[model samples]
Target: MRALIIDDSRAIRMILGKTLRGIGFEVFEAGNGCEALERLQEIGRADLALVDWNMPEMNGYDFVCSVRSKAEHADMRVMMVTTEAEITQMIKALEAGANEYIIKPFSKEAVVEKIQILGLIP
Candidate 1:
């Protein structure tokens, strides 16, 4: 499977990329939502997108909404990997079309579990 990790922080991207790749995914990355969109146009939609909430250009919420609005990307799995812990924010993300949520400062196991819950892995 292919996964895209979109975040403003390179370290966070690297960490998530490593974790996903370890779990048998081919990883791609973007600095923010806009870049992620551009990448989607370039390389096509990924099996999953690990998106961060606060980012430069377009934020994760808007990104999720945009992706969900497009028919081509509708089937793509989006998991919000963010620091936003409030229930309202979580609901907003879900409403915007996130398939799952994972708070930051997360363990690799946590990420893997979410992917499994998404049924991207068995």
Candidate 2:
């Protein structure tokens, strides 16, 4: 499977990338939502995208909306991996088209479990 990790922090991207790679996913990364969109354009599409909420140019919520708006990327799964832990924030992300949500400082097991629950992996 192919996965994209979008976060402003390079460390977070690296950590997520490592976890996804360990789980047999080919991972790509972007520093923010705008960069993620550009990367998606270049790569065509990814099976999954793990997005961060607060970003420089564009946020994760807007990114999910943008991806959902496009027919070409309709099958792609978006998971918000963010620091925002409020119920309202989670609802907003889900309503915006996110398939899953993960709060920051997460365990690697949690990430894998979420992906498994999404049926992206066994």
Candidate 3:
């Protein structure tokens, strides 16, 4: 499986990358939404995207909307991984086409369980 992690924080990206790799995913990293879009264009496709809500250039909501607008990425799974912990934010993310939402400070087990629940992992 493949995963794209988009975050402005290098540390968060590194942590998520390591965790996803440990769970048998080939991971790609991007500093922000624009970089993530470029990376996706270059790589062709990703099975999943772990997007951060607050970022430079573009934000996670816009990114999700952009990806959702594309037919080629119709099946791409987007999971919002951020510090935004509000019902409104979560609703917006889901409405914008995110498949899941994981707040910051999440545990590796939590992430794995989410992937499993999404049936991205067997």
Q: Each candidate's TM vs. the true structure?
A: 0.98, 0.98, 0.98
Task: Rank all candidate structures by their lDDT, best first, as comma-separated numbers.
Answer: 2, 3, 1
lDDT tens string, model 3, 1-122? 88999999999999899999999999999988999999999999999999999999999889999999999988888999999999999998999899999998899999999998778998
Model 1: per-residue Cα lDDT over 3-109, one tens digit each: 99999999999999999989899999999999999999988779999999999999999999989989998889999999999999999999889999999889989
lDDT of 2 by residue, 11-122 (tens): 9998999999999999999998899999999999899999999999999999999999999999998999999999999998999899999998899999999999999997
Clashes of each: 0, 0, 0
Q: Model 3, clash count?
A: 0
Least accurate 10 contiguous residues by lDDT in model 1: 37-46
RMSD of each: 0.6, 0.6, 0.6
Instruction: Name the runs in model 2 displaced over 4 angstroms.
Output: none
